[model samples]
Target: MTRRGATRNGLTRRGVPAVLLDVLLVLVALADTWANVDLGQQPAVSCALLGSFALLLRRRLPLTTFLLTVPTAMVSDAVFATLAALYTLASLSRHRVLLACCALTYAIIDFLPWPWSTLRANELSGTHNVVHLIYAVATAAAPVFLGQLVQARRELSLRLTEITEAREHERLLTAQGVLARERAQLAREMHDVVSHQVSLIAVQAGALQVSSQDPEAKRGAAAIRRLSVQTLDELRHMVSVLRASGSRPTELTPQPSLADLQRLVDGSGMEAELKTDLPEGLSPPVQRAVYRTVQEALTNVRKHAPGATATVRLHHVNGRVEVTVTNTAPTRPPLPLPGAHHGLLGLRQRAELLGGTVTAGPTPDGGYELHLDLPREGAG
Candidate 1:
């Protein structure tokens, strides 16, 4: 494509007035030629008249104007004077090919000899002749100076446009980065909260199935159903807070912590012993992380080693929190479960985002152990 086609806004109506000015100038020169007047009294004024008519095409064919006007310039003083002025304006017009042609034409016409037979005998003397020559030369040079000025202005405009686009792109990237981080954080939190609640629901559902005729078991199942629905509602509300602008819900009811470990284990239909060393007024994020670590560890134990006994421990240190869950090994090594544990991956993400870590492995004592450590009092 042409360079003009590649630009976002190519030569537009902004050039219209300048072109019209060139047309008006040509008409003025034609009128001066018709008058029998010294610089005005030159013989055969048609050469000067034709040069002025040529100015009307300055915008589209500037080089043509430069080439046609030169040889005929010596015939009429008026034509010679007008050529210089028109060349200057053409330079300012910002058409490089035309400007270069003007320079070449000027050099040739000023230096090369004209045939003696073509030189007309006219009064080539006095202040009028000197002024005419000076005006012509000045006009010829005008395009060079104006072309440079126009080029400088275009370069400055291009630089400004580039700077503005770069800043806008950076701003968009920053916004997208922040939104991604927020969405990841939200996913981790939802996994922790929902999984713990679902565990309780599962236990209650199992009880309702096995104790078919027991009134107490049925009531427990009903309570479990109601609480599960309430948990779902709370989840929706919290998600709403995460999505909304200018509002955060830190005052929502506190989530479960290490204190809930015994309940979680007992609900799994497996007996568990708790050994905890927790601190008072622990930050919410740390407590949530500790609870999730134990919850997931117990869940794996229930699914894979149903008859195994489990132990949960929470250790609170000066600046960090540690939690461990272990279970007695099944008669056979636990087989892999069919569906994936999205919860386990979420637990790890939760801990890591808060500058914490987790480890899980088979124990030499024929058991499985999972451990987590997280910042206790700071940003985590």
Candidate 2:
């Protein structure tokens, strides 16, 4: 069952026992009053029995129960049931009706016979009956006041429960959304791993054709390379998702920026010259995009141009940050690398996401260059 439904069912199940308890208590009180009281003795006792029965519907029809018990309290010894009804009404915030009902109960208890014996004594002695009337009024008011105060506390508790439930539901939704994004990312990672292995197979086939002089081997190698590249292009989007998602942190943490650029270069274990004039106060996303751009550029040069020397430049000017990576041509012939050539594409996607652009190609002086320009403000 849904949470609210379960809560309501729980209330009903608990309420049944409480209703039975109230009926039992009211009946016991009536039996005690019937044995002792002597005011309007017959009518009072019969009406008290009827009013106690009315208490059964207190939760469902509190007003009806109160109306039935109030008249009975005037003549009957059923004051206990009437007082219970008054409290129920007050707790429900029915102050206006309770005022009228309480006024009548006070008048009945004071003017009508409290027990007929007291009324007869006051009549015979000609006493003012001041103390009894005052006592009766106070008795009527006590439970109503208590009920109102208790009702305020109950309402406050209910409000707090609702607020807590809403916050918990919101947290659940947020966690589900994060899990969904993570699953999409994991799928992409699997694709990249598989595609890179296939690219290596294609690369080895090409190398085999070069080393051997057999025409059949050459033709097979050419076919493998062509088919592998085609498949890579077809699954380009999935590979792109993997390349971008793999760089992200799975937990909340400070994102990498230009400050981390040197660490990135050093971690690669590549001998490359680095330069930086990057400005401070860039947004986190822009910083991450810039850092990833440079990182991808260097990694690509290492993959495609082995044994090449590389130079990286970072510049900040006119509310924009520009990073460029340039590398000299490899002295040795190109060797097959287990990379899918998707790094540059991922960099392009990241830069564009920040409303920027990336340019990468072979340089004129027997080298390759990758350039990225990102604006600092409104770059989200």
Candidate number achieving the greatest TM-score relative to the actual structure: 2
lDDT of 1: 0.65
lDDT of each: 0.65, 0.72
Instruction: Give model 1's TM-score versus the native structure.
Output: 0.43
What lDDT is reached at residue 199 by model 2?
Answer: 81
What's the TM-score of each model vs. the native? 0.43, 0.46
List, residue by residue over 262-353, the lDDT tens digit for candidate 1: 67665654568888878878877787788778777877886788568888888877678888889998755566678576877898889888
Q: Where does candidate 2 stray beyond 4 Å? A: 1-16, 38-40, 95-129, 173-380
Report the alpha-carbon TM-score of model 2 versus the true structure. 0.46
Estimate, for each residue in 1-380, the C-alpha lDDT of model 2 and write its tens digit.
43221224324335655645666767765775676456466776667777778877766677788888766777655577778877777776546675667655655664567466655554634345666566677877887787787777776878999999999999988997787678677766657686788789878977987987998678657766766775676556554544454366443334687788887776543568889877788787887887788778776776778778888898888988888899999877776868776887888888888888999889898899989888876354
